[model samples]
Target: MSGERVGAAVTWGLLGAWVVHDLEELATVPGRLRRNVPQLRKRFPQVPERVWRRAETLGAAEFATAVGVMGAIVGTASAAGRLTGGRSGLYQSALTGFGLHGVMHMAQAAAVRGYTPGSVTSPLVVLPFTLWARGRLRKAGVLRPPRPRDAVAGTAAAAAATVASHVVARRLLGAARRTS
Candidate 1:
């Protein structure tokens, strides 16, 4: 495949992986947290259980939207980089961010010492897919090997996505509630 094709495949694969990850989280994260991580309530006493439940229930769509938006940004950057013969900084950042996200899933499972949401697929799906995508990008000369700075940028992007997901989920949930 050409570079663009490879990049596009990788981009879409990332989205697919994200959807699966979000679905996994939606299925189990909140209930697990409520059952196992009792300290979560104590840490955020202002947030009600219903609110958390609602968020968890809506997490798949919220995360999908967030990942889609982020993917668009990275995809655009990749296209622009190819056209202009420039470095794909945003694409690299995304790769780093997503790779780290997979690692975070593993870490969360480790901390809990059990199966955490997304844990089942993190190693099998997210990590491998991310690594493969990064390899493709590098081979295509779309991006260099990721640097520590890229990882930091990616982490920041992930943080921003979290906030965006919450905002989007709230709006979606609110609209649904109003309609009902």
Candidate 2:
């Protein structure tokens, strides 16, 4: 790899990758849920009424606000990654969460047996880019081995962050539907 490419494999690249993946979601999520949830509710009447209500009611405005909140977090993590040469806990934690997020997207798609927001890029851009970045970090001798507890913490952190962002967005937008 070129020297410059090697240098950029992790830091700002993390945020860049996230932006690309999230852009797909920003464009598709609200519409996908709106279009699909009704059919899902019809086909699977066992689904809880509240679950259908949330999915059906999610608006683009609230979803975009949540994305913006997450963008800020990822931006801060990227800055820390740059300053620390990818050694920052904040950056690495975000990276771990991001990679796992892609896996969850794939699983989500599989569960539904159809496309969902983020499904298209999860294998194409998200998973591959995350693998490439981890490989680059390992080659540079900076990739810390992840502990099992780290996985748990990362997943919990990701879920918490998602809920917090949506909650913040819901309050900020004053939307009738709770994005969270």
Candidate 3:
């Protein structure tokens, strides 16, 4: 197989894998948080009231809007990867963040002592796909050895994107509420 073709596949595969993993999250997050946040806050009082309050505010529509915003970002990174043959820093950074996100989901589940959004697919799809794609990128000679800065950059990007998406979601919801 041509490496270029394989590289494109690897890059596009990231979006596909993310969609699968996030489907679980999209399906579960709003309801799960609604059901458990009160108990979770009580049980883990150190988690901060704002965190609990913010989580409680997430309705399905708001969460879906956030997912759509994040999808656009991921889609852009995947396109960059495809165009650059897996050599794009945007693609690599997103890939790293996606993998770390899976790890975080596992930890979230453990910390909550129960199922959490994305936990089902974190191991099954997200992490495995990330590792496989990274290996393929390495074999294609486009891989950069990760540095501490890469991890920090990836993590910060992920966190910032999430926050931005939520902000967008909230603004959209507010606008809709006003119009209605």
- Indicate which candidate wins on lDDT: 3
TM-score against truth, every candidate? 0.69, 0.86, 0.94
lDDT score, candidate 3, position 121: 97
Ranking by TM-score: 3, 2, 1
Compute the lDDT for candidate 1: 0.66
Clashes of each: 0, 0, 0
lDDT of each: 0.66, 0.85, 0.90
Misplaced by over 4 Å in model 1 are 1-7, 39-88
lDDT of candidate 1 over 110-175, digit per residue (tens): 865777788888898889978887777667666576577777888988778667756765676678
Candidate 3: minimum summed lDDT over ten consecutive residues — where? Answer: 1-10
Q: What is the lDDT of residue 53 in candidate 3?
A: 90
Model 2 C-alpha lDDT versus the unseen true structure: 0.85
Residue 95, model 2: lDDT of 85
Order of models, best lDDT first:
3, 2, 1
Deviation from truth (RMSD, Å), model 1: 5.1
Residue 144, candidate 3: Cα error in Å is: 1.2
| TM-score of model 1 (CA atoms) | 0.69
Pairs that collide, model 3: none
Q: Model 3 over residues 51-123: C-alpha lDDT tens digits?
A: 9998887899999999999998999999999999898999999999999899999999999898889999999
- The residue-level lDDT of candidate 1 at 106 comes to 95
